[model samples]
Target: MATDHDIPSPCPSLRDRKKAATRAAILDHAERLFEERGYDQVTGAEIADAANISVKTLFVYFRSKEDLAFADTWLIDAVVDTLSRRPSGTSHAQAVGEVLNQALRTLNPDSGGLDAFHRGFGESEALRSRLLRMWADYEDAIATVLAREASLPAPDPAIRLAATQLIGIIRSCTSDEVREYVSGFPGEETDALRGWIRQAVEQVDNGLTRFLDRTSQSPGI
Candidate 1:
């Protein structure tokens, strides 16, 4: 009784296709629902009915509401991929600097999808804590890339501490507070945000240079 466009394929691959379709449906419903009702407020049962999927099916893609809470894992994977493809001889700090620049630039509130995500995040505390934890993962991922590039004997505590410091600059220096400045003065008159970013980058650069200098200094003590 359905039209040609309405009829789904009868093949076995159609089952797999339908599974993927259902998964996407669940994610769409979850994202919107979490944004609407607090991430903790929305239940899997509510999402299942909303997305027109069985609760079991929703579990197949996501373990918990927290899974849906921070659904932009793909963005972090993209960051890792970008570092993987960096030119051959890049330093750990420079590679992170470039990646941070790209990542920060991608986050302009004028940009719609992620901007809306920012709004959603700004409202959720549980989500905010998890998001804060993700910054460490982001830095560690970059540090691993740098370690492999540098052929370190043990890329542990040192690379991790260094990466954490670099990421700290980006995270702390350019914060949600920057958005206030951006909105208040959207014109060229306000250099506050840009100045903050420059200062953070320079501090990281200087710290990195100092660390390398200490490493290279003749040990005559």
Candidate 2:
């Protein structure tokens, strides 16, 4: 009684599954090697060797060795999705806070992903600079979403400022000091980090929310 379009496929196709499995395998092996040896000490050929794939094949999935270090590049897309699909009553600042909280849970200290990300900073200035650029990219992407959500005809200074303030909280959470504290104490320090997360959200909700409201009715703050 149902048309073919009415029933969604339960899972990805075989090729997609194989590709995902291969990508996961690469990340798993890369993280292990990066943990055992330092990031600078590792090579693309070595990562491919560990994953049982050729260097050429490794390059197919990841453009560079640094690209392999960042498996959570999806967080950018996740932010865009979260903001775009957020509940009708949610403010842009509230949606950004939700994504940040989710990110903390996703890349918790126990996962070793955060530690690797932090360690890469001390290992290479290039990597650290790239990480900062990635944060800037997040800001720009979020600003675009905020402007669109506000129904602005074009980029607005007020929207950009709000986006920057919102993203600063995310940057603070991932700062070296915070990463060390969370990764060092593990079970004990998570609550403190959560508390900071709440405070950061409150700051934006208190400060930027009002600024946005005012600017929405006018040209500038």
Name the candidate that leads on lDDT.
2
What's model 1's TM-score? 0.67
Q: What is the per-residue lDDT of model 1 for residues 1-221, given as tens digits with 9 covering 90 to 100?
A: 78999988677688798877877888888878866866667788999999987888788788766667666666557656765776755644455556545554666534431234445534566667776777867787767865775576555555666667666665653366755555565563124455555566667777665433335545332
Evaluate all candidate structures by whole-model CA lDDT and list the values in order: 0.63, 0.76
For residue 166, model 1's alpha carbon misses the true position, in angstroms, by: 3.2
Candidate 1: give the clashing pairs. none
lDDT of 2 at 56: 95
Clashes of each: 0, 0
Per-residue error (Å), model 2, residue 203: 1.8
lDDT of 1 at 118: 43
TM-score of each: 0.67, 0.79
Clashing pairs in 2: none
